[model samples]
Target chain A: MTGWVAVAGLGPGDAALITPEVTAALADATDVVGYIPYVARVAPRPGLRLHASDNRVEIDRARHALALAAAGGRVVVVSSGDPGVFAMASALFEALEGVPAPHDLDIRILPGITAMLAAAARAGAPLGHDFCAINLSDNLKPWVLIETRLRAAVRADFAMAFYNPRSASRPEGFARVLDLLRADCGPDRLITFARAVTTPEERIITLPLSEARPDMADMRTVVLVGNSATRRVGRWVYTPRSA
Target chain B: MTGWVAVAGLGPGDAALITPEVTAALADATDVVGYIPYVARVAPRPGLRLHASDNRVEIDRARHALALAAAGGRVVVVSSGDPGVFAMASALFEALEGVPAPHDLDIRILPGITAMLAAAARAGAPLGHDFCAINLSDNLKPWVLIETRLRAAVRADFAMAFYNPRSASRPEGFARVLDLLRADCGPDRLITFARAVTTPEERIITLPLSEARPDMADMRTVVLVGNSATRRVGRWVYTPRSA
Candidate 1:
C-alpha cells in the first residue's frame, strides 16, 4: 500500500464547523500528530497512534510526520485552524526543504475555517471591506515589523483582525498595540473582542477604542479593529461593502 | 414554525470544504437564496425553494431573504466563501438597517473556509505571515481608493491576496495593478496565481513579479503577492514564519 501525508485544519472549537474533508482524512489516518490540545480533539480508536507534542515544537512535529510517511504510514498532521495560517503547513514545508523524499510521495494541504473569519462572522461582518490579519506575537517576528504593519494597515483604511493579542507571558504587547491603534485610528474607532468564539464560553463585545482595555483580551481572544467606515446597526457591526 | 436566517459560506469550490455547520443549516432551510452559481451548489429537495439571482444584485437578494424570514420561512443565504469576507452577511445587515423586524427572529452567521486561505494552503502558505485581502474590482468602490490601498499594502511589506483580479469588462485594471505591483514590490518578488482552487479545474502557478502578466489572471483567479521574505522550496512557494 502506498503511504501519504496530509495536513488538515480542524476549524474553530465547534465540531459542527469541521468540514467533511477533514473528517474523512482523520478517519483514514493511521497516525495523528499535533499540539497537545489539538491532538486531544481527535477521538482515539484502536490501531491508531496519537503523537501530541508541546508548543513551539512545530518543526519537530513536521519532521516526525515526514519520517512516518517515509516508513509507509498514513499520517495526518492537524492544527486548530487552517494549517497554512500561522499554523503547521508552512512548518511542514520548511522541514521538507532539508529532506529529500521520493517524487511520488503524496502530500496534500487541506483548508479550514480560520479564526479571524470565524470571529468576524460572529460580529456581523466587521471585515466586509478590505482587511489585514496580523499575528501580534513577537516570538517569530520582530516587534518593529509588527508596529510598521499596523501603521501601514491603518493608513490603507483596512479593517484588522489580530491573533494572539494577549498571552500570559506577553501581556504588555497587547497594551502597546491598543496604544498604537488609538494614536492612528483615534478614540472613536470601533474594536471588537471575541473570546473563545463558537464555543459555549464565547463572549463578544464591541467598544470604542478609548473604552477598550487590554485586559479584555487573552490568549484565546481574537481582536478586530474596524476600518474608518465600520459602524453599528442595532446589535451588529459591519463595514459597508463599498468604502 | 419559527423563522430564522443563516448566511452560510460554501467554501471556495469543493463540497468537502463545506462545514457540517453550514450543511446542517441548509438541511433545515425552507428557502435558499444566493447568486446563481453558489445557489446551485446546494442540493434540491422537495420542500426547498431555491432563489438564485444575477450577480451585482446582492442587496436585492438580501432583502428577499429577510422578507422570507419575516414571513416565518427558514432561509439560508449562501456565499461562496466565508460570508463575513466580502460576501452576503454584511449585505444582510445592510438591508436590516432599512427594516423593522421582530427582535425575536433568529439570525446567525456560519463561517466557511475562504478563498485566500484555501489558495494559500494549495500554494504552500505565501500568507503564513501577516497579509491583506483586497478586492481589485472597482464596481462599488472608487478606482483611486483601490490604488491607494494597493500602495499602502505594498509599503507595509505585507503579503496580499487580490480577489476579482481581472474581468472581461475591465481588462486593463489588472494590468495596471501588475504595473503598480512591479514598481512597488520590485521585479523579483514572488506571486502566486491560484485558479479554481480545491476544484477539479484548479491550477496554481508562481512567478516573479517581473514575469507576471495581467493575462495570467481572470475572474476565477485569486492572486497572492508574497511578502519580502517569501521564496520557493522545491516546487512550493511559502512565506517564512518570522520577519
Candidate 2:
C-alpha cells in the first residue's frame, strides 16, 4: 500500500458531528497519532497502531507521524476540533519543513466542525455577522498580543469567539479577559459560555458581560461575545444579519 | 406531530462533508426551504416539500419557514455553509422577532463545515492561527465599515478569511479590498483564493499579495490572507500556531 498522511479532525466531541471524509481517513489509517484523549476516541482495530502522547508535544507527535508515513505507514493524526484551527495540521507542516525529501510524500487535511461554531449553534446565531476567532492561551504567544487582538476585534465591532479561555495552570488570564471586556464593551453586551458542547456534560449560559465570571469558562469551553447590535429574540440570542 | 424548524448547513459543497446530525434533521423534515441551488441538493421524497427561492429574499424565506413550523410542519431551512455564518439562522431569529408568540415554536441551528475552514484544509492550514472572517458584501453594511474592519484586522496581524468577496453587481468592492491588502500586508504576504471549495469545479491558487488580482475571486470564492508568519513548506501553505 502507498504510504500517506491524513490530518483529520474528530470535531468537537460528538460522533454525529464527525464528517464522512474524516471517518474514512480514520478507517483507512494503519497508525493513529495524537494527544491521549484524541487517540482514545479512535477504536482499537486489528491492524491499526495507536500512538497516544501528552499535551504540549505537538511538534514531537507531528514528526513521529511524518516519519512513520515516510516509512510506508498510512498515518492519521487526530485533532479534537478542526485540525487547521490551532491544532495538528500546522504542526505537521512545521515538522515537514525539516524533512529530507518532503516533496515525495502525499498528505491531505480533512476539515471538521469546530468548537466555536458548535457552541454558536447551541447558543443561537451569535456569530451570524462578521467575527474573529482568537486563541486566548498565552503559552504560545504573548498575553499582550492577545490583548491587542481583543481590542482590535472590539474596535472592529466584530462578534468574537475565544478558544482555550482558561486552564488550571493559568486561571488568572480569563479574569483579565473579563475585566477587559467589561471595560470596553460595557455591561449590556451578551456573552455566552458553552462548555463541553454537544457532549453529555454540555452546559451553555448567556449573560451580560458584567455578570460573567472567570470560573464559567474552562479548557473545554468556547466563549462567544456578541457585537454591539446582538440581542435576544425570545429565548435565543442572535446578532442581526444587517449592521 | 409537533412542529419544528432547523436551520441547517449543507457544508461547502460535498455529500461527505455534511454531518450526520444534519442528515438526520433533513430526514425528519417535512419541508425544506432555501435558495435555488441549495434546495436542489436535497432529493425529493414522497412526504417532503422543497421551497426554492431566489437571492436577496432572506427575510421572506425565513418568515415562510417560521410560519410553516408554527402551523405544525417540520421545516428545514438550508444554507450553503454553516447556517449561523452570514446565513439563514440569523434571518430566522430576526423574523422571529415579529412573531406573535415565537417562544412556542421549536428551533435549532445545526452547524456544518464552513467554506473557509474547508478551504483552509484544502490548501494546508493558512488559518491555523488567529483569524478574522469578514463578509466583503456591502449589501447590508456600508463600505466604510468594511474598510474599518480591514484596517483593524491588519493592525492585529490576524489572518483573515473573506466571504462573498465579489459579485457582478459590485466587482469594484473586491478591487478596493485588493488595494487595501496590498498596502497593509506588503508584497511578500501570502493570499490564497479558493473558489468552489470541495466541489468538482474547485480551483485554488496561492500567491504573494502583490500578484493577487480582483478577478481571481468571485462570489463562490473564500479568500484567505495569511498572517506575517504564514509560509510555504513544499507545495503546502500554513500559518504557524505561534505568533
Candidate 3:
C-alpha cells in the first residue's frame, strides 16, 4: 500500500483542542513531523515516532515527512492552529508540487481552531460579522502585496484579523497597516486586541481604531478590526445584525 | 465553596476540538449538563455525573444546570460550537440575571471552534476578509431585524456566513436573506455553500450570488457571501487584503 500523509491542526497549544479526526490520524500514524513546540504537545502514543525540528527548516521537514510516507509509512505532519492558515499544510503542498516523487501520496488537511477564531470567541464575537486575516511579516510575500490586500479589505468594509502584525524587525508594519485602515475604513472602527489567546496570560482589549496605540500590539497579538456595521454597546463590541 | 458554572464550546462534533481549559473544567466538574447530542460527544469519566435533556428544552436545561451549580455542585454547561453563537450560553446568563441568587457564581466562557469557521475552512479562504453570520430563523427576533442586519452587513461590504438559514417551518427565510444580500451586495458577489462541515458528508460549492439557488441550501448549510473585494483565482475564492 502507498503511504499517506495527513496535515493535522493541533489547535492553539492545547491537547484537548485537538479534533477527533486529528487524534485518530495521530493514533494511526507511524511517524509524526512538526515544529519542536508542536511536536512536544502530543504525549507519547504507542508506536508513534516523532521527528521534531526548528521552525525555520519547513521545506526540508515537509520533504522528510513526505519521503517517509513514500516509503510506505503512515506519517502525520502537525501544525498549531488550522494547518491551512499560515501553517505547515500549504508548505507541504508547495513542496510536493516541486518534487517528482516515486509514489502517489494522499495529502489531507484537517482543520482546527485558528488563533483568530479563538481570539474572536474569547473577545465576545468581535468577528460576529465579515472580516479579513492578513499577515504583516512580509517575509515570503512582498510588502506591496500585503499593502494592496489590506487596502482592498478595508475598502470592502471587512472586519480585519491581523496575524504577525508586528515583530522586532517589522515594528512599524502594523502601525502602517493601522494608519491605512484608519484612512480607508475610518478611525472610529472598533478594534479588539487579543494576546496569547487560550493561554493563562491571555489579554483582550476592545478599542476604536482611532484610539488604538501601537505600543499595545506585538507579534503575539491578534488584532481584530470591526466592520462599519460593528457597534459598541456598553463595554462589549459587536457587529450588529445585517439589514 | 460557592459552586461555579463554566459554559464550554465543544467544537463541531469532535472531542479533540475541545480546548485544554474546557477539558480541565470538564475534568474538574461534578456535573455536566447539555442536550443529549452534545452530552454524548464526550468520553465517560469517573465521578462525572451527566444530565442530558431533549433538544427543545434548552432554557429549562440551562435553568436546571444553574440550579445545580447553585446547590454547590461544580457544573459545566456545554454547547457544541461556540457557546455564545446562538447557543445555550446566552440563555444561561439570562436565566442567571433573573435568579436573584445570594451567592456570586463565576461564569466563564471557554471558546471553541464554531461551525462557521469549520465551514469556511472547508470551503477555502472565502472568509479571508470581512464577513458576517446571520441566522435566518427569526424565531426569536423579528424578520425585520434580520433583514436590517443583512442590509447593513452588505452595505458594509461584509462577506456573510449565514446560520439557521432554512428550516421546515421557515423555508423562505434563506431566500429572503439571499435577496437582500443580492440587492445590496450586487449579483457578482461570490457565494460558498457549505454543508455538514467537518463531517463525513461535507459538501462545499462556490458560486456567484446571482447563481446561488435556494434549492442548494438548507438549515445545515452555511452560506458565505464574499465581500465587494472578493475575487476568484481559479477554484479558490478570497477577499483581497487591505493594509
Candidate 4:
C-alpha cells in the first residue's frame, strides 16, 4: 500500500463544482475524513472508509488521517471550501509536527471554489477591484486584532468581504464591526449580503451600508462592504476603477 | 416572444467548471456575443448565431447584443471568468441606457471563477485575511489614482493582487508600482507571481518584495503581495490572523 495523503476542497455546496481531478483523488483513497456535513457531499464508492466528526475535532481528525496514511493506507482529508483558506490544510500540517518516523509520506493539496468567490459571483462584481476578507469570529483570536484589521481595510478603501461574520454564541461581534466600518467608510458604501450561495436556499441582497441593519445577517451570510469607488447603476452593484 | 439576456461567466478555462445552470442558459439562447476568444471556448451547437469581435469593440458588441435581445430573441453574452469583474456585464448595462424599449428586458449575470481566486488557490492561501486587488493597466484609467490606491493598501497592510501588471507598450509600470509598494509595505514583504493559473502552462513563484524583479512577470502574470502577517513555510505561503 502506498502511504499518501491528499487534502481536497469540496467547493461550495454544489457537487457539480467538484473538479474531475478532485473526483479522481477521492476515488483512489482508501480512507476519507472530514467534518460530517462535507463528507456527505461526495459520492460513496467501493473500498472507501469514512470518518466523520463535529467541527471542533479538527486536530483529532487530522491526527487520525495522518496515522492512517502512516500505516500505509491511501487517505484523503476533505475541507468544504478551499483547504488552504482557514481550513483543514493548516490543521493537517500542524498535526504532522507531533508525528514521528514517517518521512516518506506523500502529501498534496487540491484547490476548490471558496465561499467568498461563490458569494462574490452571485452578487455581481463587488470584488472587481481591491478588496479584503475578514472573519468576525473571535473564538481563537482576540477582538482587538479583528478590530485593527477592520480599521485598516476600511482606511485602505478596499471593498471588504467577511467570512464567519456572526455565530449563535457571539452575534454582536458583526454589529460592532459594522459600527466601526460605518465610522471609517461612512454610510453610503455599497453592501451585499449573501447566504447559502450556490445552494437552493441562496439569498443575495445589495443595499447601501447606511441602510444595512444588524438583523440582516447571520452566521451563514457573507457581507461585502464596498469601497468609495463602488456604485449602483439600476439593479446592479459594482466598484469601477477611478478614471 | 419575451426579450431576455443572460450574462454568463465561463470559469478560468476548463469547460467542466461551467455550472449546469449556465450550460442550460447557453443552450436555450438564440444568439451569443462576446470577445472572439471567449466565444470560441464554448462547444458549437446547431441553430445558434455567434457574434464575435476584437477587444476594442466591446461597446459596439454590447449594443448589438442588446438590440438582438430587444428584437424578441434570447441572447447570452459571454465573458471569461466572472462576467461582472472587469468584463461585459457592466458594459452591457452602460450600452442599454439610451435604447428605447416597450418591454422590460430580463438581464441575469451567472458567476464563474475569477482570476484572483484561481491564482490564490494555485499559490497557497495568501488571501486568508484582509486583501486587495489593484489593476496596473493605465489604458483606461489614470495612473495617479492607481498609485493612491496601492499606497493605501500597502499602508493598511492588506495583501494585494495586481491585474494586468504589464503589457508590451508599458513594461515599466509594474516596476514603478512595486517601488511605491516597497515604500509603504517595506522591502521584506512576500510576493507571489502567478502566470496562467489553472491553465496548461501555469507558473507560480513566491519571492520577497525587495528581490522582486520586473522581468519575472508579464501581462499574463497576476502579482500577489502579502501583508505583514504573511509567512513562508517551506513550499507553502500563508497569512495568520493575530491571536
Q: Which candidate model has the greater DockQ, 1 or 4?
A: 1
lDDT of 2 at A113: 90
Candidate 2 local lDDT, A1-243, one digit each (tens): 579999999999999999999889888899999999999999999999999999999999999999899889999999998999989999999999999887899999999899999999999999999999999999999999999999999999999999999999999999999999999999999999999999999999999998999999999999999999999988899999886
For residues A1-243, what per-residue lDDT tens digits would candidate 1 score against the true structure? 677889999887899988898999999999999999999999999988999999999999999999998888999999988888888988888888888653456888888888888888888899998999999999988899899899999999999999889888989989999999999899999999999888899999999999999999998899999999999887888999997
Q: What is the per-residue lDDT of model 2 for residues B21-97, given as tens digits with 9 covering 90 to 100?
A: 99999999999999999999998999999999999999999999998998899999999989999899999999999
Best by lDDT: 2
Identify the runs in model 3 with alpha carbons over 4 angstroms from their true place.
A35-37, A40-67, A91-104, A120-160, A177-191, A204-211, A225-243, B15-24, B27-68, B84-86, B89-104, B120-160, B176-192, B198-212, B224-243
Question: Looking at model 4 chain B, which ten-residue stretch has the lowest summed lDDT?
Answer: B234-243
TM-score of the second chain, each candidate in turn, equals: 0.98, 0.99, 0.91, 0.93
Q: Which regions in candidate 1 have their CA more than 4 angstroms from the true location?
A: A102-104
Question: Measured by TM-score, how close is model 2 to the native structure?
Answer: 0.99
| Model 2 stretches with alpha carbons more than 4 Å out | none
DockQ-based class of model 3:
incorrect
* Pairs with steric clashes in candidate 1: none
Q: What CAPRI class is candidate 2?
A: high
Best by DockQ: 2
Clashing pairs in 4: A130-B133
lDDT score of residue B135 within candidate 1: 92
List of chain A TM-scores, every candidate: 0.98, 0.98, 0.91, 0.94
Arrange candidates, best lDDT first: 2, 1, 4, 3
Q: Model 2 captures what fraction of native contacts?
A: 0.93
